[model samples]
Target: MFAGSNRLTIDDKGRLAIPARLRAQLADEYGKELAVTLGPECIEIYPAPVFRTMAQQIPKIADRAKRVLVQRLFLGNAVESEIDGQGRIGVPPLLRDMKALGTDVVLVGAYDHFELWSYAQWQANNTEGQTHYADAFAALAVP
Candidate 1:
């Protein structure tokens, strides 16, 4: 169970050292291979099997418009990465720029996958999401 959030720093070369607790979870579930992909507001890191399963679920369609949408959303931006001996994974330049990530970042565990966010960006996003979903969330929690 990956839980809590950790503030992380990206080295000049874009390598992020996974938190020790998260590393233990990855090691147990994924061995050493993981996949990193762009998310709506951040980046998602997943165990290889989980990533592959998600990729496979992208709908197959012969129509050009649907194909383009799926391709751009799922295939165009995906990146595969592996955790090194020191439990660090490098973020690609494009992804870093997309999320406005700098030396400081926050890694948030999302059950099956993890999300990487710039500290400021995460704060803004979290606030917006909470406000946007507050009503729905409260209803879901009814006893």
Candidate 2:
């Protein structure tokens, strides 16, 4: 039940300290292992077990294009990491480079995983989301 958003800073070495509340939950239930990969517009992080479960659920495909896409884009991009004693998880260089992440970032809890967004990127995404808010809500049938 990861939820809410928090502003954070990436250390010079590209490690981010997970917030205490979420950190405690993860430590108790999942230990320190994590999987990181690039998302559509941000970096995604999932507990290692959670990631494994999700990976297993990815439907098998006979279509060559779909299979290739999944393998190359999702599985190939994933990197395993461990949260350090200080609650910090190091972002993979490839993942960080893809997202153009800098020191200032925001951690957004996206239901099943977390999205790491550079501050500027998050702001731009939020602004664009506003333009589609009506359509998005309508699609969800939310009143």
Query: Candidate 2, clashing residue pairs?
Result: none
lDDT (0-100) at residue 79 of candidate 2?
89
Model 2, span 1-143: residue lDDT tens: 78999999999888999999999988888888999887777999999999998777556677878877777877889988898889999998788888999889999999878999999999999998999898888888556
Task: Give the clash count for model 1.
Answer: 0
The estimated TM-scores of all candidates read: 0.86, 0.90
Ten contiguous residues minimizing lDDT sum, candidate 1: 66-75
Worst 10 residues of 2 by lDDT: 54-63
lDDT of 1 by residue, 18-128 (tens): 987788888888776878778776888888888888777676576878777766855677778788888899888888888789988999988888899999988888888
Question: How far off is residue 125 in model 2, in Å?
Answer: 0.4
Model 1 TM-score relative to the real fold:
0.86
Point to the candidate with the largest TM-score: 2
Pairs clashing in candidate 1?
none
